[model samples]
Target: MNFDSYASDVMAATVEAVNQLTPGHARGRDYPAARPDLGDLVGEAAVSSEDVDELRAYAFKIREIFVAVDDNRIDDACEATNTLLAETQAAPTLSRHGGEPWHLHFHTPSERWARGWAAPMATALAIVLGNPMHDRLGVCTATVCDRVFVDVSRNGTKRYCSTACQNRVKAAAFRARKQV
Candidate 1:
């Protein structure tokens, strides 16, 4: 099964986590990021208050990977992703969950933290990066936003993390041109 989309969701979520946890960049108007909400992303995994810091750190690393990609530092991104993938030790298998069709599973029941929360995304990236679709990993192109996204479009040309960000950027540009 194609894990690209699943991996992209993880990347986007991790980027959001990073932007939330490490604030104070002082870019522009205040748009409060959603608090490090790993619960929605973890999907049935038990997350504790004590797990926040570790998850945050893990997210930072994921952010670094996307930042490297956005900065056109492919080598750095590869290195960072590889390091994370190695640490995760993902093992691929086929399984069904939540009444969904059978799909490839990257983490085991015993895996937690890195494997449980992070490995699937890491393995997804590994799967894509091994192919020509490596460039799909990217950061949001919206101003005052440092989120990440994966381009699964047919032409692979995705910019903003979401439609909202796209509209914001376009509106900002329109206002700028009007003022000029």
Candidate 2:
């Protein structure tokens, strides 16, 4: 359970998935057709429409963690994460399967995609929150996007979800200056 790598990878992907897959106003991706990362996170399980529905709801819950972190409410984020962990029954188990090296997994081997994901997402977030890296989780500052991101930079100054969003904000500022 390396919190840095685990949170940067798994939790990052899950947060991005929530931004993409969650129902909302015109996010820029064709979520179902474009999300191969979701498949990777769920391992061999297929994602169904029902799973998407579940994830859409779950996205709101996950957002609470990010929002709490963003608002400097670490305890609120922890409480929310604790509830999710309890609900998901997260357990850390290590095993080597499919010829891969032994690594940690949070859900039972047979858990459904949504439930399975809930456990690890919560666990990864918990790892981050418990450590000094709790501030690593953030919501994008871009006006058009509410995507979450993990700040993995050396200086930890990251503020947007992606370079595109960063550029968008910069360009918007430039346009505003030009208009003025």
Candidate 3:
């Protein structure tokens, strides 16, 4: 698979991290009780409690990239992503792990958990933002959720993070119609 595919996964994990870490008043602090299973995608090792704290803090900033793009503020989105890329000191290198083929990686392999994760994600967003596919990034339209999403649908009409959120919205609309 292309290394760019990892960018999609990075966006997904970052969204989960943001939504779980910063739920609105309607919900209590729902910061994920545990680290998300990004192992398969990002090859995350066992993270320390310190790593979790750093990840939580960084996730909020990552979410801003989607929110800015969704709001049609392309410049803002690019600026934010650029700042993140700088903060993480993202640098590209090629390496092969185990039996896998060589692929591009951003950030030093010896970096801390948070730096390792953030660098690649920022790099990926920078790549997307620099291309015509920038519209693929979005924040969920669901009022109750602010999770980020990538519109991979053919027509790119996606507005919610997942079917669960879409169903929730549709169900609410139905209830409103019934009341009327």
TM-scores of the candidates in the order shown: 0.76, 0.84, 0.83
Which one is best on lDDT?
Answer: 2
Kindly report which residue pairs in candidate 3 clash with one another.
Answer: none
Q: Write the per-residue lDDT of candidate 1 for residues 73-163, one digit (tens) a residue.
A: 8888888888988887777877777799988767776666544767776766666666667777777777776666677678888987778
Clashes of each: 0, 0, 0
Residue 85 of model 3 has an lDDT of 88
Name the regions of candidate 2 deviating beyond 4 angstroms.
25-39, 42-44
lDDT of each: 0.68, 0.77, 0.74
What tens digits encode model 3's per-residue C-alpha lDDT throughout 1-180? 222677776666666666555444212123343535444433537877677678767777877778889889999999999899889999998877778998878977688887877788788888788878898888777765666778878787898878888888898899999999
TM-score of 2: 0.84
* Clashing residue pairs for model 2: none
Instruction: For candidate 2, give the lDDT.
Output: 0.77
| Candidate 3 residue 11 C-alpha distance from true site, Å | 2.6
For 1-180, candidate 2 gives per-residue lDDT tens digits of: 246676667776677667766544223333342342465655666778788667666677888898899999999999999998998899988867788998888988787778777788888888899998789888888775677778878788899888988888898899999998
Error of 1 at 13 (Å): 5.6
Q: How displaced is residue 120 in candidate 1, in Å?
A: 1.3
